[model samples]
Target: MSGPVSSTPAALTAPPKSPKVAPAPPAPAAPTLRDSNNNNNNNNNNNNNVVIDGILSKLLGARQTADGSCARVQLTNRELLEVTRRAQQVFSEESMLLRVSPPLRVFGDLHGQFRDFLLLLDQTGLPPGTRFLFLGDYVDRGEQSLEVVTLLFALKVRFPTSVFLLRGNHEVQPVNRRYGFFQEVTSRYNLEIYARFGSAFAYMPVAAVVGEKIFCVHGGISPRLHNLDQIRDIPRPARVPKQGLLTDLLWADPHPAAENFTDNLERGGGVPGAFRFRPHMSRPPALYKRPRIFCRSTTTHYLLGA
Candidate 1:
């Protein structure tokens, strides 16, 4: 038999009260990229100096206004200094041998062709969209070394993972100090700024591998480089040296005409017996030989979106 029904009417029963959970504290907002350079601390203040996005709007605004005329980019001393520090922070976190992925655009030496870089940005997409591996030689030789390096550094700061910058022979102190980059920096600002650039260069990766299928560097393989780990072994925050594997990796060139040498000439310290690589070398270092290797002398190239 069914249980007996309540004697009272249904309206007389009290309703169950719902739990009073204070609406979850509105989900915390995402951290925004404030123009920390500016002292404006108000999170919601509509300050014009604020960097609304990851971009430096003031700087990017000037870039967006760039016409065909190759004009030198303008920046305040404070802005330049800030950029240096920010970029150094980004580069320092990277390894000596960058392990990158594929579908990249490679470039040769761009001796500060800022206008060309801009055009390439127009042709190919910018960072966060396209992955790029620059081979180095970003400074010296080009009239607008400051603009080029600054732009590259800024991009690296904004999109560290998407952008890869390898060290070239010219990135070293001796090469750039004389080949025009030093003079350019000193002319625009002072020796201090030039030295700051040196600090940034010290952290640039010398080599990169993409999808574990390709090897990339500013120059070519060094005799000392028996494996990818060997490249990672070299420490950074130092200038490229005069001898050894690191030197050869940045200095060695392909001899299209093999007739001039017997074997391994100046491969390391101009020593005849020192380790060397030959043009169209049938056998690469055993560890990394399986990957097809290609390199350029600069980060000044256009890259399409992957």
Candidate 2:
């Protein structure tokens, strides 16, 4: 028929076509060192989160003390150290002054009153739902100083943005060591744990501004303070100085009798002279030039849940 169908059959006549095969997808690129490191970091973070969750569960579920006393929650020094270290890392990134937007619930002087603190949270709601700015004095006074501090660190680590902690007078070693916190820590854990807590405390923000209108601090204004930059300039891992802007911020009390500032005779009359202000600081041209600022503070003398 067509030259006897050519010498070769039609199937074999098509120019010896190569077999149709899909090129294998390029071999997946090998993971780089960066990818491996990232994966490890993620895994470590996940493990830390699990540990924190366990600690929180233990704290929230523990029986409330009837006598209003601290019943230790059986956490080891290692666990405490881990929590403190993480808290330090979080605090180190924040400035001495924190600027926050409103719809915030400001609390002052928890004073180691874990039960009362819990009740307050229950009423106001927790993080993400309602933001909180704690105005220091977290430890000492109440019998549950350890519980209060540990819970706060756990919360700070878990909700770094939503919940903020400011440095209170009790947060300093010189103050806390004389108060009940040192006794509680030493009795339950050890001096090293107490020291670690001190280290973490040094990193706490000293003050906060909310809605850009209100200035909040554990104590009142300091005479040494001229502008907000002074607060911003204060370095981290800072121990409360003997006498200066930092000390005044943490220890100043309100005294209507005094005109500007007077020695805080109540606390041995060293530094942190008490502050007194009416509606505005009109005398200081520098302060008057700045935007209107309202101050809210829990005086050093006043202890919440006392």
Report RMSD (Å) for each prediction in the order shown.
17.8, 21.0
List, residue by residue over 32-66, the lDDT tens digit for candidate 1: 23232334335443342222232343323322222
What's the lDDT of the predicted structure labeled candidate 2? 0.67
Query: Which sections of candidate 1 miss by over 4 Å?
Result: 1-68, 259-276, 286-289, 298-306
Over 1-306, each residue of candidate 2 has an lDDT whose tens digit, in order, gives: 001112322111112223323321111111111111123346676677666655666665444344543345788777798899988888998888899877777787888887777656545545544567888988988888888888889877766776789988889887778778999899988999999999999999998877765677887677788888898888877866667888877877766566556777677424444444422334333234433454445632221110
Clashes of 2: 0
Worst 10 residues of 1 by lDDT: 23-32
Please tell me which predicted candidate would have the highest lDDT against the true structure. 2
Clashes of 1: 3
Model 2: residue 297 alpha-carbon error in angstroms: 3.9
- Error (Å) of candidate 1 at residue 72 is 1.6
Report the lDDT of model 2 for residue 70. Answer: 30
Pairs that collide, model 2: none
Off by over 4 Å in 2: 1-41, 65-71, 268-295, 299-306
Looking at candidate 2, the ten consecutive residues that score lowest on lDDT are 25-34
